[model samples]
Target: MPDAVVVEGLSKRYGAVEAVRGVSFTVGHGEIFALLGPNGAGKTTTLEILEGFRTRDAGRVEVLGRDPGDRAEGRALRERIGLVLQDIAVEPYLTVRETIARDAGYYPSPRDVDEVIRLVGLAGQERRKVKALSGGQKRRLDLALGVIGDPSLLFLDEPTTGFDPSARRSAWQNVRDLRDAGTTIVLTTHYMDEAQALADRVAVISDGEIVAEGTPSTIGGRDIARARIRFALPDGCSVAELPVAGLPVDAVPAEAVPGDGLVTVETRKPTEALHELTGWALRHGMVLDRLTVDRPSLEDVYLRLTEHGAPEHNTRRSTR
Candidate 1:
């Protein structure tokens, strides 16, 4: 299938500092592609370039098979694209229905105002003025306006920035609905879990470049490691004396030895480590209590990649 958006060696500079440096990626039709990164990581700049709001300094960009820089093409391109920007302000005097109706004028075909209001969970509030709504309601208004045109491609920049947990989840559902309806979504967000939940694929950018890209579960080679096993130790048992082969003793913290007889051990190979530990404990007439194993998460991978500093190469594939 053809790509919904394609970027090759895309770059943008601000006199001395480069905001985006040779970034390249593709968003397939009907796929949710997330640009995950921290503040000042060039996510917004990249989105703006694709939206035709900003010009790129170098590289090729194709949106819906047309160059976004061309004015005529850009207008046609805009009709197919819906944008929910990070910072948006609405006229305080305009009611929810009024706001959506006003935006619907820009497109040749727009969804019914009432349907759009309900789609964004603003049904009862449609009569309320923008200034009278809460923060979350305002965000919903932004979404209604963006999707009024029923765009095939949607760019959501921190779509649920200040939303509470429930509101965020609701917004996520709306995104999923769009994807289910064959809309291609390109999302930029700081929340790791949000990216992990909604994105089919993700690209992590740092220092004005993409540093890592992959599925959420295996990004940064995290799945290559084993699970961690934690349990309580019997009285008089020492971590050094624990007969767990292939387990790093250093990974067990000294503070983990509770007065009530608890020990936590982290291992790269949980199966073998658990077998050895269990056998050794039984032989020594000791019992392992509250044993549990856990896998690494996307947060772990993110910290490993961008915690210290940006890597040398612009991109690295996850070792799943």
Candidate 2:
């Protein structure tokens, strides 16, 4: 399938400070792509450029197929792209159904009004006025309006910012429903777990550059990062007599745990180490307490990629 979005050598600047430099990536059709970054990382600038709200200084940006820079073409393209912006303020007096029905008239092909409301978790809120809704409810209304047009592409800016945990999961399923219906989504959010749960692929931008881009599990080489194995020892158990034979002594770095009977090991090959450790414990008739294995999470990779200690890239991030 053709790419839903393609950006090449995209750069933007504000006064003396550069916001984005040579950012390039592609979003596959019907895919959920996420741009993960911290504050001032140029994420907002990039999304706005793609949405045609901000003009780019240089680059080839194609949304769906046509260039988003052409004024006449961009105007028509706007109808095909939906935007769910943060802090969207709607007319307070308008009821939920009235608000969605109004926006649905803007597009040539709009989703069913009642369906959109139900899809956005506003089914029971059909007659509620905008002013009377809670923060999370208003956010859901924002989402309803964004997708009312039945646009092929959707831009969700922190779509679940005000959602509670249960509501957030529901919102995630709603996004999945959109994707299953063949909508291409470009999401921007501060929550790593949200991205991990939804995005098919992700690009982490920092200091106006994309430092890493790949599947959430492997982003920033996380698949190769060390695994942390933790287990609490019982009374009278000693680290000296512990059984871990398969791994090299230096291959796994053992760390001291503060409690009386706790041990932690950081190793590149955790499966082998754990196998040996568990087998030894079983033979010795010892019960392992709280044994847990943790791989590098998406959050861990995100932190390391955007952290100040990362290696510097003197060369710009442009192949062209």
Candidate 3:
């Protein structure tokens, strides 16, 4: 089967400003693909082209084996895909069930109304008017409308924008369920953790170009990036006094005080470094307060990749 979506050498311009420059990627069937970038990074333009909302200046594009730009096939393509944008446009007077049921009528094979309601965590609020729903609840309603069509492909933009922690987690599970059931999803969000938890693959766009594309764990070489070891320096201990394996220790200023001696060691061998540091602390009968070993998080890599003048990153394909 053809991939769910494909774009090669895509480019877009708004007068003098080039919005998207040579962006290229593919979303496989049943894959959760994430497009990530800061504001004004051309993410919106790239998505608009794929959604057939805007035209691309140069590229080959296909969505669900059809050209989204083809007006003759627009309705057919729209039937096979769902969209949940950041805006909420439901009628205020319509009840949750009413709103969802209304949209289900647009598609030929919609999911059961009640099933979609529960899927989006609005089961108990089915009878409540849209105007009465909370901000988070309304976002859930947005999701319900998007999926009621039982689309083969779904597009989610900041899907959990107004959701609280609990609601966000529930929404994540709902999205996973959709993907597991043979749905292809294209997601865009500023939440790094969301991408890390949900995306099978991710692409980072910066300054109108794709700087990196890879799995959430390995993007920007994060899997091989040095681990950070941090600890508050013992009251009397100096950086040079520590028995590290020739690893340089940098004194990081503690948040509470300007010159407080918090230190960090960046190394690839975290396990060995931790053992040696803990052993030294044990031998001296001293405590290493707030010791922590952490690898680079998705947010860390994202910030680095999007920073001005940051080096371009390479992509690594994940084995399916």
Number of the predicted model whose lDDT against the real structure is largest: 3
Candidate 3 has what TM-score? 0.91
**TM-score, per-candidate, Cα-based:** 0.85, 0.90, 0.91
Candidate 2 lDDT, 179-248, residue by residue in tens:
9999999998889899999999999999888999999988888888788888887557787777655664
Maximum-TM-score candidate: 3
The digit string of per-residue lDDT tens for model 1 on 121-193 reads 8889978999999988888888888899999999887789779999999999999999999999999887889
lDDT of 1: 0.82
Q: Kindly list the per-residue Cα lDDT of model 3 for residues 1-320, writing each as its tens digit.
A: 88999999999877877878888999999999999998788888788778888778998999999988889889999999999888857789999999998999999999999999988999899999999999999889888988999999999999999888998999999999999999999999999999999999999999898999999999999999888778888888787688854333532222322465567777777777777788898999889998888889999999999997323222211110
Candidate 2 matches the true fold with a TM-score of: 0.90
Window of ten residues with lowest summed lDDT in model 3: 311-320
Candidate 1: regions farther than 4 A off: 231-238, 246-264, 275-292, 308-320
Ranking by lDDT: 3, 2, 1
